[model samples]
Target: MRQPREKIFITCAVTGNLTKPEQTPYLPITPQQIADASLEAADAGAAIVHIHVRDPHTGNPSMELDYYRDAVEQIRGKNRDLILNLTTGPGGRFVPSHDNPRIAGPGTTLIAPERRVEHIAALKPDICTLDLNTMNSGGEVVINTPQNIRRMAKIIRESGVKPEIELFDSGDIALMHALLDDGTLQGPVLCSLVTGVRYGFQPSPETVIYARNLLPPNTEFTAIGVGRASFTMVAHSYLAGGHVRVGLEDAVYLSRGQLAKSNAAMVEKAKRIVEDLGGQIATPLETRDIIGLPQPAR
Candidate 1:
C-alpha cells in the first residue's frame, strides 16, 4: 500500500449547489462569479477546486449542462494547473411524500445515472464526486442506490475522470469495499468522508479518524465536516494521514459567528491551519500526481 505524503492538499469547494445569496452573500451564482471564485481560491493556496453551479436568476442549484460548460471553460481558460472537481450530487435528492408512500413528492430530484454524469463526459473535469449511500439527509432521502452507484462509477471510469467516493457513515465502508472488489471502482480510491449532515455521521474528530481508518490500504481521503465541524474535521483528517477540504460548500463561517466573505478566505484559513501544523501545502501538480492523474500537456 502506498503511504500518505507529508504535503497537505486543500480542496476549496467553491459555491456549492444549495446556498443562496441571502444565506451568504459570498455564494457565487453566475458563471463568471463561480469562475472568478475558483481562480481566487486557487490563488489562495487551494490545490483543487470543487464546483457546483447555480441558476443566475433564481440562485437555485442547477444541473444545466451549459452552466457547467461555461464555468469550467472560464476556470480552465485562466488556470491550467489546478485540479477541478465538479459535483454529481445534484440529481440524487429525494423527498418522499408523507401523504402517499408511492408518490415521489416535491423536491424529488432523482435522475438516471447517465443523465447525472452527462456534464462529466462533456467537460471532463479532473475529478467528480460520487455520493455512496441512500440516506436521510436534511430531512430528505439522498437516494444513491448501489445499482445507481455502480452505473455512475462505470460512467466516471469510462470518461477517465476520477471519482471521489463520498462516505457519510461507517456502514458505507462495506459498500466501498464491494465497489472496489467488483471493479465498479478502480484501486487507490479517492474518498471524501463527510460528517455533520442532518442524519449522517456525527461531526466529531473521533468519527473522522474512525472513517479514515476504515478505508482500504493506499486509499486517498478528504475529510469534510459540514457546517460548524468543517475546520475541526479538516485538522483531524490531516493529522490522521488524509487530506482536507474547506469552502462555502461545507461552511459559511470563517469562525464562530463570522461569515466568510469569500471562498479565498476559507482557503487562506485552511492554508494557515495546515502550515501551522508543520506541513507544506501541496501544489496543483503534486495533487494530480498524488491522485495518479496525468499532468496536462505543457
Candidate 2:
C-alpha cells in the first residue's frame, strides 16, 4: 500500500459544467465571479482551482475562448502563484433523440476533439483535466474514445500544460496504463479518482484502496467524492495515501441541508478536515514542488 503523504494538497473546483444557477445562488457564473471565487478559495487554502466557464446571462456552460481568457487573466493578475486547472470536459456529452437513437438530441454538445482543448492551448494554464471515460451520465452519454483522447492529449502536450487525468472507473485507470505505455501520456502522472457518481466509481474505503492499487508508480492522485460523499471522502482519501478536492463543482452543501455560501467555505472545511487528521495542507509553491512543476519566477 502507498503511504499517506505528510502534506496534502486541496483543489477547489469553483464552478462546474453541470451545476446550474438555479441550484445555488452562490454559484459563480460570469468571468469576474469565477475569478473572484477562485481567489477566495486560494485565500482559504486551496492550492489549485478547477474552472469551467459559463454563459454570463443564462448560466449555461460555454466553450467560448474569450470567457476563458478573461477569467484566467483576472485570476493570474491577482495571484501569480496559484495553479489554474481548466476543464476540457464540456464538449463530450451526447443526448440521443427519441425519434432516432443514432441522432443527437438537443442537449448534445459533442464537437471536434480539437475544439475541446482550444482554451488549454490558448491560455496554457498550469494544468487541464483530460477525462478518459465513456460512460452513462444521467440521460446523456459522455464519449471520450481513445482516438479523441489521443488527439486532445497531443494538444495538451504541445501547450506545455500538465493534464490532470480524471478517471471515473477502474477501466479508466486501465486505459491510463495503456496511454502511458504507448507514450501518449507522460509521467509521473497526476490524476483524480472521481467517486460517488451513480454510474461511475462508487464511494467507499474499498473503492479508494482498489483504485489506488491500480495506479502506476510515481502517480499522485486526489480522491474526489461528489454530492453528499464529498466531505466523507476527504478523510478516506487522505488515509488512503491521496490528496483531496471539494467545492461547488463536487457539492453544493456545506453539510446536510445547508447550502455552501461560497467555494471558499468548502475549501476551509476541507483544510480543517485534513489538519485535524494531522495532515498539513500544501501551499501552491510547495504543491508545485511536490507535483514536479517548475517554480514560478519571482
Candidate 3:
C-alpha cells in the first residue's frame, strides 16, 4: 500500500438498481426515501451521493425521469453543495433467449442509448456514471458496446456532468483507454474500481492495487467492494492512494452477522476507516475541488 492521500473523499451509493427492498427493508425505494438517505449519508461525511431511482410500488429499479427529478430536487432542496451522481447504467441488461440465440429473452433490458442518459440532461447533476465495460453481470449480460459507450459519453459530456467510469475488471481499462483515444471521454474524470461482483475480480488490496496501477494518470479512482469486502476495501482504497465508497448499494451489512440500518451507517463506518489511517476526510465543497469542479452556484 502506498502513502494515503491528503484528502480522502467518500461517495455514498444510497441505492443501487439490483438490490431489492425485500432483501433489505432499509433500501430506499421512494423519491422521498432516497433523498432522505442521501441526506443521512451526507451528514455521515459522504461528500457525494451516488444515486439510482427505484419504483416506489415494487421497490425495483426504474429509469422514470420523474423519479430522478424528484430525488435530485429533494437532495438539492437542503444541500445544493452535496454532489449528486446519477446512474446512467440501467437499460443495458441482455439475456439471450434459449429457444433462439439471436432474439432477446424476457429479462432483456436493452434500450436506445439516448434513453439511457436522458436524465443527465434533465437534472444536470455535478457527476453521472458511465459504465465502460460490457460484462456478464450476474446471469445476464450487461451490454455497453463501443458505439453505445461513445454515444453515452457524448451526451454526458454535452451536459457538463462529469462521467465516473465504472470498471468491473482489468479489461475495462482497455475500453477506458479506447474511449480516451476517441475523445468520447474527457480527462481527469473519475473511475470506480468495482470489485466483488459475480464473475468479477474478487475484492482485496492486491486487486485494488492492480486496477489502480492500470488507471490513467489523469483519472482518480474510488475502490468499492461488494458484500463483506466493502469495508475491508475501504482501508485498501485509502492505503492505495484512492478514494472510497460505501452504502447499501455496495453492501447491506455493517459487520459480521449484522445488516446496516441505513446509508448513514455505511458512510460513518467508512469515515472511521479513513480517519483512523491518519487522513483527512474531505467535505463536499473540498471534494468538489478535489475532483476539479466549481463550487455550487449561489
lDDT of each: 0.88, 0.95, 0.90
Best by TM-score: 2
Judging by lDDT against the true structure, name the best candidate: 2
Superior by TM-score: candidate 2 or candidate 3: 2
Q: List the residue pairs that clash in candidate 3.
A: none
Question: Which one wins by TM-score: 1 or 2?
Answer: 2
TM-score, every prediction? 0.97, 0.99, 0.98
Write model 1 residue lDDT over 1-298, tens digit each, in one string.
Answer: 2233489789999888766678888898999999999999999999999999988899889999999999999989989999999999989988889999678889999899899999999999999999887888777888889998988888888999999988988888889999889889888989898888887888776786678778898888988888888888877778878899999988899999999999999999998887888778999999998999999878
Which of the two, 1 or 2, has more lDDT?
2
lDDT of 2 by residue, 242-274 (tens): 999999999999999999999999999999999
Give the clashing pairs for model 1. none
After superposition, the stretches of candidate 3 with alpha carbons farther than 4 Å from their true spots are none
Q: Give per-residue lDDT, candidate 2, residue 297.
A: 70
lDDT, ranked from best to worst: 2, 3, 1
